[model samples]
Target: MPVIDFVTDEENLTMTVTAEFAAPVERVWAAYSDPRQLERFWGPPGWPATFTTWEHTPGGKAQYTMSGPRGEKSTGTWEFLAIDAPHRFEVLDAFANEDGTPMEGFPSMRMTFEFTPAGDSTRMSSTTYFDSLEALEQTVAMGAIEGTKMAMAQIDAVLQDLRDYAQGKGTRVELLDDTHVRITRLIDGPRDLVWRAHHDPDLVRQWMLGPDGWEMTECIAATEVGQSYRNSWAPVGDTPGEPFGFEGEVLLFDAPRRAVTTERMQGMPVETLNDLNLYEEDGATLVTVLIEYPDKETRDMILATGMADGMEASYARLESAVLTPER
Candidate 1:
């Protein structure tokens, strides 16, 4: 877990805060660009921010307000100075009246948000420039650094969810035994969303797509124990191969937590027992999927088919398609 780093250099009249997230560069940029996503974490832990008007264009304006736990309110406005997709943005931040009008004679701070690729993650660097050392010192003395750190800390969960939605490799595989395997993923979302993603047919079709150009055509699922469910997949276009489908029976069902299911492919010989477990940590979800094979040969055969890789892709699609919507 990476924390936000704050640097203040009053001599240069500049301040900076940087944080890293386990997500792609584009997703990080989206959080800042989208008003709804921005409202989710723009303020410190105690103060909640809401965006009333946001326009992501040069020369445009964004207006938001932060309300304290005891109902105190502070409004701020941003005048966009520059815009670059998925890389950087610059804005002039100013104190504003309740109606979003900038207060006269109040000094404004210019800030730039930068997103850079760090391996599979993104490093976000925000630099705020002040007109004078006095302004910088005044802002710092007003708990700017600590407040910024607190606000930046909220990006991790948001970025993780965005990453999972953008690229489906969030799931990891672990061999439990010769006849059993476990798949786990750190879902940067609530347990309920994850549960709905699995049980809801509309959401299931978003990420349960199989192979390239193949989409889930039919998904009928019921999580009640002993209930039968079926899913089918077909090519998006008229390509080679006929459509295939499978049916499964739920052995155990626990809403938003765990489930046990038995499944067999249309022409497969053995029935695979799958145990799905979801645990909540803070605001994130830990998903563990245990598959119990009847024998080592069956497990090996399934693994050889690149089962794990396919699931990763599917889950990624699920996150990006079902979890992250265009703002």
Candidate 2:
């Protein structure tokens, strides 16, 4: 087994990183040359990435979007300089605007990837060259090297796991926009358990509030799509407060699947979206909740308000309710 290593030369504005994989040269080559296979394990951990466009020929390009952490969308074009099938490939990479137009302030860099067969395994090396030392310094400050290494490690792990399973990984969650709160885990429990925890009036009273004495005064769930639901909450601390609330229509509801969609319409009145998807995995059910916002600004605001932390707490409470044995 070969270890991963990084060599940087700030004066030359260049960095070279190398790693060895236990897999055959063919396997590692396919992972890089094929876009479809690349998407399965291309991103860093905790973020989902989608490859929008990819062409392997010289002067061809590739674009992708990565979300999670902070919902940043980036695009880049690749000009293939050399292509030696299953051996080596080189290209020029640059940042582009969302509309696919080249942007200022970003350095166009040359990236070359070489794959050499070392016995039954493969030795992989990547060399990145910048236009100038100033550009390199700026990229270093942006943590480009560290971020790239992290992403590559994730790809390696994902590839090894897929080989072990003899199958690919499952679909991932993509960040729609920038938001303050990160939804860490989407768990699935029994339909009755989920419904009782989210819809039952009594269950709502306990875990939805915080330490400052908050209460859910009203929670209404309508079965129909166009029908609406409203939740009104108020603080009950030493300082009396007015109600803070949200109201939205039921976009979807399927009891068997235990899925629901709610749109927020009051208090903050911001358009907050929530989706719940439930299905069976193994012997137990899994539930995935997706939340989207219009942009990154509001997402940051929600994060600053401790909403993400509050959400994790709420999920923990739900877990407790299901895991506790029934009398």
Candidate 3:
């Protein structure tokens, strides 16, 4: 097991767990920074985690659900309070309802995670501070300590399998639920540039074209909440396919980190929520988009249209035509 010390102090109303990993600090940090790596081991052995939302910066929030063996499920949320990259971070951890609101009767805790270099390895100390002794006792009674140990035990493998989790995999998609899908692509550029590429009309027109023989005819990007944005595409010359377009109104906009929009095909009533998040680690940015469709049929129809392959083509073009040239 990676956990070497598990201590619960009722006097201080705190529980601290210390674990050692056979990897460098950067590698260990990446395991937690990337939601894909985190979901693999965040839950105990039987309950696997699925992070629906991940915003790693300070003042951001992350939401995840853990599915149990017997169809049971638990939801949780983390509100980031502080972040010191590759070293320490703090979050307000709490039980959450299905809609992501804090669950009543469950106490929230201030959890701090610190990573330090130890010889050829890294030492991670996680400390959870409760508001009251009753709160600490309540959480401990709910298998928090044992569950945490089991969860940390699974991280060693994630830290070791670096290639499987990182870039060179191209754009990938995950079915989060019947109506929700997640798409991820790791871009070889900084987060700021990648965010700008999605918003700047000139940069967007250069890479957002999905495939060869296609051209972006209109590029109107929304810069603030409630503003509408439209993008249209047309085949070049005699290339097959009709002109298509999408229009959306921005619901939330956090530059260089996240954006949420309501998207729909032109003149179509069916709409989907598109959530875009960007995270930078080790000079590269990971782009994650969570799309919520109207229903299963719509989700399947979109996937059947080779959405992932088209996204891969656009991301490839982005690297070649925009990022590479800038570098």
Highest-scoring model, lDDT: 3
Highest-TM-score candidate: 3
lDDT order, best first, reads 3, 1, 2
Per-residue error for 198 in candidate 1, Å, reads: 26
Residue 14 displacement in candidate 2 (angstroms): 1.0
List pairs with backbone clashes in candidate 3.
Answer: none
Task: Flag the better candidate by lDDT, 1 or 2.
Answer: 1
Cα-based RMSD of candidate 2: 9.8
Question: 294-320, model 3: which lDDT tens digit per residue?
Answer: 899999999999889889999999989
RMSD of each: 15.5, 9.8, 10.0
Model 3: what TM-score?
Answer: 0.59
